[model samples]
Target chain A: MGKYVSVRGWLECDESTINEVKKIRNDFTATYNEGLLGEDKLELYQSGWTFPEKQINWTAYVFYGADIREYHLDFMKKQLSEMANIQDITGYFLIDDHDGDYHLCWQIYENKFIESEQENIVFNK
Target chain B: MGKYVSVRGWLECDESTINEVKKIRNDFTATYNEGLLGEDKLELYQSGWTFPEKQINWTAYVFYGADIREYHLDFMKKQLSEMANIQDITGYFLIDDHDGDYHLCWQIYENKFIESEQENIVFNK
Candidate 1:
C-alpha cells in the first residue's frame, strides 16, 4: 500500500499579493536547502517555475510517506504555526493519515471561527 | 491578475503510509465542510478516488486567491504544521505569493536539521 496525504484550501488574496508570497517562499526554500546540504544541493531543491500556474491554483498539495506518526504531526503543527506567524495567515486545514487504519483532519479558521466552534462544540458536548 | 501559490516537498515515508494519510485528509476535509456548511458541502470537499493517484505523488499542491498577506502565510504554516503533527510528516516546504511583488518559500525538516542549522548560522553570524 501507499501512504499519502492531501491538503487543500484557499488563500483569500489578490494576484499581486500572491506573486510576492511566491518570491518569499522561493527565497526561504533556497535558504533552507543551502543550510541543509550546503550550496551544492540548493539548485536541486529550487522550484522550477516562477509564477504560480497550472494545477497549483485551487488544487490539492499532496504528501506521501511510510507511516503517519505523532512526531510527524507535531512537527507539522509547529512549522505551520511558525509560517502563520511569519506570514500572518488566517485560516486553513490539514488532513493526514492516522495510525495505520484511520485518518485525522482538522481546520483552523480565524479567531472568530475558533471561538464560535469551541463554544458550539462545548455546548453540544 | 489572479493570485496563486504552490507548496511542494517530499514526505519521507513508504507507499502504504502515503495512502493512509490521504484517507485521513479526505475525511478531515469532509468533516470541516460538514461543520461549516452542512453535509451538502462535504461531498464537494470529499476527495475522489479511494487511493492516492495522478500527479498527487510528486506534484506541488497549489492555492490561489487575492493576496499573500501575513495572515495567509501564517494560516498555511499553521495548517501544514498541524497536518505534520496529526500525520507525523517529517519534511515539507511551502511557496506562496508575498506582498505584491515577491514570493516566499520555507522548509521545515526534523530536529536534527534545526539544531545543526541554528548552530551553523550562529557560528557564521
Candidate 2:
C-alpha cells in the first residue's frame, strides 16, 4: 500500500528562525536520503509570506514519502515546538493513496496539537 | 541567473475536469521533457480539499524549471480559463532567485485575472 503524504504550513519566525530552518534542511539532507533532491524527498519549497497574522512570517512545504511521514511529523514538532509555543503557527498534513483509496487530513497547531478531520475518505485501497 | 518558479492553486472541478488534467499531464509528458518524472518537472501534487469555498474542489501544484515558467503559466491560463470564467478559481505564481536575489509574486484569479503584488523584492541579484 503506497501512500503519498504532503505536509505544509505557514511558519512565523524571524531571521534567526529562518537560519535555523536552513540548517535543519542541510542537516536533514546529510542525515537521510529523504532530503530535497534525495531519494524519498521530492521537493522542499519555502517562501516568506505576504499576508501576515500575528508573528506568522513564512510558509514551508515538506514533500517526502509518506512511508516515513510520521517520523518527519515528529521531527517537525520537535523542531518548531519552542517557537510555536510563544508564537502562532499552523499547518496541515494530508495523506492519500496513489490510486485514490485513502485520504487523511489533520490540522496542526503549535504544540503538536493535531486534529484529525478526515480518514478513510474514499476507501479505494 | 537561474530562477525557481512554483505555480500552484486550488481548482474547483469535477471528475470530468480531473480526467482532463490527467490527460493534460500525459500529453504534456509526451510533448515536453517537463512532465511528472520528466527531466525538468520535479513533482505534481494534486489532492482533494476538505475546505470548501463556493465551487473550489481541488488543489494542484506544478513544480517545474523556471527557465520555461512563463510558457507553463500561459498554458495554465489557457487550460483553466474556461473553468474560471464560469466558476471561482484562483492560484498564485511565486518566483525567486536560487540564492535569494529576487522575489516576485502574482495573484491569479478567474479569467486570467492576475495581479502583480510584488517584484524586485530584493537586490540580491
The most accurate candidate by DockQ is 1
Kindly state the fnat score of candidate 2: 0.00
DockQ of each: 0.05, 0.04
Write one digit per residue (lDDT tens) for candidate 2, span B1-125: 22344332233234344445445545544454434234433223112111211111123332211222334454444444443443333333344434554344444354354434443221112
Best by lDDT: 2
For candidate 1 chain B, which ten residues in a row score worst on lDDT? B115-124
Tens digits of per-residue lDDT, candidate 1, B12-60, equal 3334555555655555554443123335333332322123232233433
Measured with C-alpha atoms, the lDDT of residue B107 in candidate 2 is 42
